[model samples]
Target chain A: MRYAYYPGCSAHSTARDMHESADAVARLLGIDLVEMKGWSCCGATSAHQTDRVMAASLPAANLLLAKEMGLDTVVTCAACYSRMKTANHEITSSADMRAAVADAVGQPYDGSVKVRHFVEILLEDFGIDKLRKRFKKSLNGLKVASYYGCLLVRPGNVTHFDDPENPTSLDRLVTAMGGESIDWPHKVECCGGGLNLTRTDVAVKLSSSIVEMAAASGADCIAVACPMCQASLDLRQKDIDAATGKKHHMPVLYITQLLGLCLGIPEKELGLSRLMVSPAGVLKALQPASSHQV
Target chain B: MTIKIKKQSGKSLRQTVEEMSGVDMSLCYQCKKCASGCPVTKYTQSPPSEIIRRLHLGAGDELLESDLVWMCLSCETCYGRCPMDINIPAVIDALRSLALEKGSKSPRGDMPLFNRKFLEAVKAYGRSYDLSMIMGYKLGSGSLMQDVEKFPSMLAKGKMAVLPPSGAEKKVVKRIFDRSKQAKGKKK
Candidate 1:
């Protein structure tokens, strides 16, 4: 299946591991993920914080590009997916918004282009049964806490994503890969993602709480679809330890990274070493660890 | 902080906010579901529901003076759970724009500044460059040493991209920013 991929700013920067692993998985699955060239940032929360129309306009620039490619758009960044979905919802549902967005984009913006997160594509478009058949190894004993941080599955009406409170797509994917996705309470908890840089103090508390909850639920590692969630949960352990006076190092891997590991793809392709938290613990959990030395 | 209602032209803030956010604050019957699910309430003086109540009460100056608007993560937990379907995060965005426009003091401080710096980077590079935006925020806020210790590790781990994102149609992004500014201007 062919799809236009929009890797938002963080995908290549803070969450490059996710980008790398996702690309590797796409190659393995033979899905044609055409990169949306000339795409700009989604403006993240910065645009919407000032004006809603501007938020739509920024993503509209990228959305129009996907439409130009004549393919449904797919994004690895939850923020980009959310922004694009929200824009599409608004523009398709409201004639006035369509006009304003078209005006802002310097041309007619086709807001009807479909946008799906890469995970959605993997689960819905690329069926789990098909994916399971491709797995060379299994996440046999791995207990992964699937963290679907905000943006991916909130404001359920507009996003029409999985359940806003307790999304099961990530969990279901992990389970399909022969991993036990622990039923964690903080599955859809807010990690205060956008505030990570500006409000580091808040990020520490929220990120720490997610880690704590996952550890409590006996998750060996946390799998995330969103870059910001991976960044906050993976990068902030030191700060969390400093603030909360608790030693913690929970492996936060992209969902694709785990899939890559089970597919028996080369570890370097997934950028495993680039991760902040060492996944050594979880990597060892895979039976015949020597065979899958990541 | 519970906004002390000073007058009853209450309709003005409510009307402006509803028009800007496209959310009817009157739909809220103080269900408090938003407040119950909001994750950041412990860090702030007011919860998500209070923002809606304040808007309904037309707590203009008092509302802007507080730090509530700048604190919303836009996580949309409140918006999702609201039995009345009130988009509290949109209301928060309206409140944030209003606060920034009025140059009101932020109790928590530096969030709005960071937002401006972030947008400025997006405008310049067509994508966010971390180092530049941090430098910009440091210059504006003077908290130069904050988050510096983590920089070396970020670079070592390849988490930080030293250069601005390229290949973007910069002129197009600039136009979007400019037109949006004008869009808000024409509205006011």
Candidate 2:
């Protein structure tokens, strides 16, 4: 399966590990992930919040490039996925919006391109049973909280990706990779996103709640699909712990990184070392001597 | 307790919200379902239900002025929970856009400044340059000293790229902004 990959901004900077791990995992999975050439930003939360036209047109600009390539676009960032999918939804739903987007982008776009989250690609393109068979090292019942955050499943009509309330895609992925997906209510909770940069107080409150819930649920690690969620949960975790005066050292891992590990890819290659909260203890337990295969 | 409803004559704020958001404002019926699921409702002066209620009451610039609009996470929990499927985020987005247009004074800190800096980076670099965004935001937000302690660690960890990424899509991105502004100008 071939895809025009859209790595968004975080993948290049803060979430570089996610990009590297996803790249490695794609190679191992035999999926051809040719990056969409010189792909621009998806306008993310900022664009949509300020200007509607820019929001639609920014994603439309990238979608048009993918359309030219004649391959469906696969996005790793949940925020980017939401923006691009919403752009496609808006363009396809209304001719006026489509016309405006075309005018702004200086190109005709009928919203013909399909934009999919890479997690969806892993599920639909590579079957669960097939992925299960390829796992070299089973997670051996490591409890994982599949945190979807906001964008992956919310505003159901626009995204239409998974269940808005109770999404099981990440859980199913965790299960397929031999980990125990913990039943947690905060799976779809907001991580305070960009507020992590602007307002640390609010970000700390929201992030600490998420981390506390994951820890309280007995999760060894929180698995995320969005880079922003990863940053919010992992990078701000220390501050969260400090703010609450708790000793919860919950590690956050990208889905790609976990999949890479189960497939026997080295931790370094999966960008494990780049994680703010160390996954050292978890990784140590997953080694052959201490590991249990089911 | 008796509720004093301010009945206003002329164009309703509900009509303005509907026109701005393209969502039927009347679809919201004080169900409070949106407020119940809202994650940030505790922080806002008026939750989702109250925002819409005020809109129905023809409350004008006050709705735009409230910290509630800016505080909204746009997480769409309320939108998802609403049985009426009112698109609460979209309505909030409209309110935010209006706030930007009107330069409505907000008590909600530096979110608006941060958003503007983010888009300015996008407009300039085709994508967000994290270092530039951080630098610009710190300067614009007048808190250059806030996250300074984390910079060395960030650079060491490769979390912040030193150079801006160049892409062939930059020109087209700039054109997109110019064209959108032009289109909006013509519309007005």
Candidate 3:
């Protein structure tokens, strides 16, 4: 019931909704999330690409804290989860590498800390049946495209969370909330991620296809776990549409936000309005159409 | 787009990549599976498979200088699909590090700038300070106008804070960066 929460940089910024709704939902479910004190960045793509030792060392510092706490680390950002898991895999797999990381971090870590993505925690820690019983409202008539993006389920051996090719954890979560998770091919595709800052054109080109495919699958909105994917699909959506010459007004919602909505959490409290594309249309579907006097 | 294959001598590219990345590209047998699975392959002149192929053919410097390495999304699709279990992302990471270390100008645009600023922010604050990173990125990359319209709204919604956050372990983070820098210097 207790987890050392490692909400990455995104949780404080662009994807605040994911962090807020995750806290709200976990509290409602009787799960305690203790924020890992003095935790730093996970190094993300920048560290690994720049220095291998620093990349592994950054996550090692956090994992050492988690080990000290004697609790499993739960990460909401897929990029952070991937980095931490990769660091864990690398450090544990090689003695020399482990020593180098320990030397850099000024502490020896045995990689004993278990890193779990928020999706995995929701699925494995909080059983689907138990979650189903707790839903106060239904997501009926809501068709959602579960966007896994890349990190959460890639390099199968290192992540070991779900099938890298085709994951159904998000779909199962959607189904448990009385919503339909659309089957789509672009579920595991790259959203150009950090490339948004480095290469906006590529991000737009890649995110456009994801949005187009989600809409083509008849999804009212896209559910994402990673803030990078959420930002790509939500913030750059306007550019994607402008470039593609398509009017796909698809709303991107975090998986936590979607779950919180079904749990009857208020929209504002979940930071729903922070999304670039408005999720109002999809949210309004919760009410009977006949009841509205429009 | 003809890749002039020059058979070079003395510590081949494959050996260097393998030594640095700990991933033996010699295990790659022209499967092209990695290239096929790579999402950014279309964006690059040479795909992951071709990069490995060139490395297999004793290709060097060219692969390092190529934009293909910079364009790699590092999505790990290639790594996951490799039958030989070749970690392509790690290899590309090694290539990137080598390229940057050698003072080779990045052919793929402002990625190096953004990455440098991002890490600089992390080194200073122990985490990414969005406002500072943006300002630094804008100054370094001159991308001031991009995504400018969303600033006010993001600020109003409390999505981005105007001030930077000093993480509790800033000194520890500084030490980590210093150690890595010293280690890299020793390696050179």
The C-alpha TM-scores of every prediction are 0.96, 0.96, 0.96
lDDT per residue as tens, model 1, B1-188: 33687675545787888887888778889989888888888988888877777767767666876666787888998888888888888888888888877778854547888878889989998998877888888888878888788789889878889877797878789989999889868866
TM-score of 3: 0.96
Per model, the share of native interface contacts recovered reads 0.76, 0.75, 0.72
Error of 2 at A142 (Å): 1.1
lDDT of 3 at B28: 84
Better of 2 and 3 by TM-score: 3
Instruction: Show the lowest summed lDDT stretch of 10 residues, model 3 chain A.
Output: A285-294
Q: Which stretches of candidate 2 lie over 4 Å from their true place?
A: A288-294, B1-12
Against the reference, the lDDT scores of all candidates come to 0.84, 0.85, 0.85
Which residue pairs in candidate 1 collide?
Answer: none
DockQ of each: 0.76, 0.74, 0.76
Candidate 3 has an lDDT of 0.85
Candidate 2's DockQ: 0.74
> Order of all candidates by DockQ, from best down to worst?
1, 3, 2
RMSD of each: 2.5, 2.1, 2.9
Docking class of 1: medium
